[model samples]
Target: MRRMQKLAVLGALMLSGAAHAQSSVELYGIIDTGVMYVSNVGGHSNWLADPGTAAPNLFGLRGTEDLGGGLKAVFKLEGMFSLNNGASVNGLFGHETYVGLRDDRWGTLTAGNQIDFMFYSLVVDRWGPAFPFVSSLSLRQGSFAGLNIPNGPPGNGSFDFDRTLGAPIPNSVKYLSPTIAGLQVGAQYSFGGQAGSFGQNSGQSFGVNYHIGTVALNGAYTYVKYPELNHGNDGIRNMGAGASWVVGPAELAALYTNTENTENGARVAVYEADVTWTFSPFVHANLAYQFMKGNETLKNQKAHQETLSVMYSLSKRTSIYSGIALQQASGGPAWISLVPGPASGGSQVTGNIGLLHVF
Candidate 1:
């Protein structure tokens, strides 16, 4: 009788263990780096360590657990690090660390450090920073005097597609609504977390998207506050919209962003258009043009950027690419180029061959 009781208890424990094992976890990451030459830095031609304008290097743990009914619990912990020096990022998991719940019929609500609604749009314009070769060049000029630039890529910081406030807001909570009739919407808020002020450094953003057939559209707005930068608090208010069309092996996309500094009232606008073509299962090409106009439009202070990227896949997780990036300015400040110059009439050009691997 005692032996039978013990076996019964053991079987019950095994069943419980199996039930708990229904949860799943995954480890994923990407690494990309390259080399290149800069036209003029401090009036001298320079060849330097070009950390390819690809994804930031990172690794992360993400998992989901199925609860009863149609609900599920989800969590993600990811970190950014430098590939050149192998140094762990201070964020530890600051890149994207969050916990939440989801339901197919309902939606998803997550809390922690996360990107804004515009950054997460499913139909995000393809004219973003993730393109090959010229991504770093784009990021270098992504910022203005008082505004912020969206962080680029999943784990890397160099190449992001869209230009927005790049830093993930801390102490944040977000909600994503389920798609209804090809339309999806999301909203997010990040508490300032200040000791006594609710509006000091907080941020709020919302995005709406629509997709039908081979066409998709996106629109987003964000307000980010900066408290410590200047004696008086400052921030950036942004509004953006994008559209894309897909036909056969080619897709065309256009994105426009306008940003205004709260304290200085400086306005900076960027317009981008891109074309992507897939030649085969293993080959692809992308061509793009970007124009940035800043402050008083009357001054003719603007910059133009162009990029061409050609890529070949070696496997599902590995690829090689070569890209050419060029920048020209007519009346913009030196801020428009990687070199130290308002070189009113000069231009910057770069080329690189790089590789990327994911697992």
Candidate 2:
């Protein structure tokens, strides 16, 4: 009886060790803050408290449990907040929160609030060359707030695809496919939580990416339903394709995007190009241009925006940045710069200098 009990105790200890080896968790986040000067916001030069442009100001936790047989269970919870202010996010894991199952060969399946296809397109190909300097948020989302004349400097106008379609749709499901020969694909779907209405506020998106040595390419498509927009159930469809190439110390990229609102009949299209050069091991500069066109009935008929920025890395986790942006608009309401108020001809200039640190 004593020998049998010893064997049982040893088996229990071994099983506990196996379980410990199969489970793990981690925490991570970033904080960015800076100051920006706008040349003309509401006909005045303004200095504003600007947040970091590289990554979202957020913190998060990630955990995984090995299920054996090349499978694992994973979960993540993240949130975003303002670094300049002491305010904490009120929403539960507003930035991202998801639980999923992953397989080395089969890929991953997850459900919860998560970013859509455009994020992958920008990160993988479209904005790869300009990232950390020019900021995809500024390029893709545009300076709508600065472009509104009557709404002054804080109004949001057209060309905000991510904001309009819900960049991270809640109550969503996503699938990420394993890369094969430098190629990968992903898809997502969100169910709008309107009782008795499954389609309301719902969204769907897909993305594909391919990379080979110095060249990369990506494309994405998304269709979303906004039950309360456009005076009814408005359907919006967005599509984008882009490519980037790198040679030595220089990188170049281009992207084209289309967004249309079916119910409201509003449409917007944009073309953008960028070039980034490494002046030194720690200093980099990026120059970018964007052309935006919208429906005649909508706010902006045509706009041209240009951005120039430089970044100096203090270390792997810290950097200092400065940037300038100019914008000109024709057939639009007014000239609005990327960070300032709208001008009479929809032309304005903005500049910013700031620091960012990651941990």
Candidate 3:
């Protein structure tokens, strides 16, 4: 009887150890805020609290559980909020919420709300340094509302047409493949959830990345069907390619993206280039330029934008930053992304200073 009891106790202890070894979880978040000055917003200059210029205000939980045979169950729940008013930016856990399985030899498969490939390939893998150095105002959104993105924000019908600002796709299933010979690939599909149609309001995305030495190349394509357009058959289509090279303390990158609305024959193309330099362990700078042009459907609207930013790190998790952005538009009023409204004239300028902390 004593021997049997000892065996049972040992077995229980081993089971507990195995279970502990197989699972882990982590919590993380970032908070960023400061003040901003806009030279023109609706024909007036104003100063306001910056919400997410340096980096987005976000919090998240990520966890993984080992399932033996080099596989694991993984999940992430992330959300965004406003630092100025403590308001949820996209609802609770609306930024990203996914559960998936990962295989050591393969990659991962996940389902839920998630970003598409345009952000993953161009913004993240290819020109990753730009995000840390440039402000969110550098993204593209001009006076080209003819694109008429369905369900876009009021008065701004073409917000984030390129989908590089971490826009989420709802009810999506995504697959990412492991890097093979310096190349990796990913794909995603979103179910429209329409009762009688499979393609209504659906979305599809594909992305690929290849890296060798200090150079990386990336490409992505995305198409989303909207019910308000062509009886849910016509939609928005986006495609882009980008490349980046690292040189010691500096990284240089360039990208081109095209967006089109099939419903109304509207199209826009954007060209961008930027360089990021690390001057010291705590100081960094970035300079960037962008040009956007629209087709006849958008009244041939065009915009030219330039941005410069500098940052001083207090530590690995905290920083102080400042930036200025200038924009000039022809064929319509000037509009910068994240600004409250369109410029009354053809030009606009903005400056900002901010603090960032991560945990």
TM-score of 2: 0.84
Best by TM-score: 3
Please report, as a residue range, the 10-residue window in candidate 3 with the lowest summed lDDT.
1-10
The digit string of per-residue lDDT tens for model 3 on 1-359 reads: 12322332343334334446668767899999889899999889999998578888999877777889999877777889987788886676767777778998899998777789999898989976656776787777888888999766787888888988878777788999999989999999988877888888889999999999989999999999888899888999999999999999999999999999999999999999999999998999989899999999998999999989899999999999999999999999898887888999899999999999999
- C-alpha TM-score for every candidate: 0.83, 0.84, 0.93
Candidate 3 wrongly placed segments (more than 4 Å) = 1-19
TM-score of 1: 0.83
lDDT per residue (tens digit) for residues 1-359 in model 2: 12322332343334334446668767688777788777666567788877555555788777777899999877777777778775655353666667778999999998777778877665544556556665533444343332221211245544355332225656678999998998989999987766886777778899898889888898888877765464325666788888888888988888888877676566778888888899998999888898877774465567788878888999998998888777777664344333434554466677778788877
Stretches of candidate 1 exceeding 4 Å from the true structure: 1-20, 122-143, 146-166, 229-233, 297-300, 333-345
lDDT of 3: 0.85
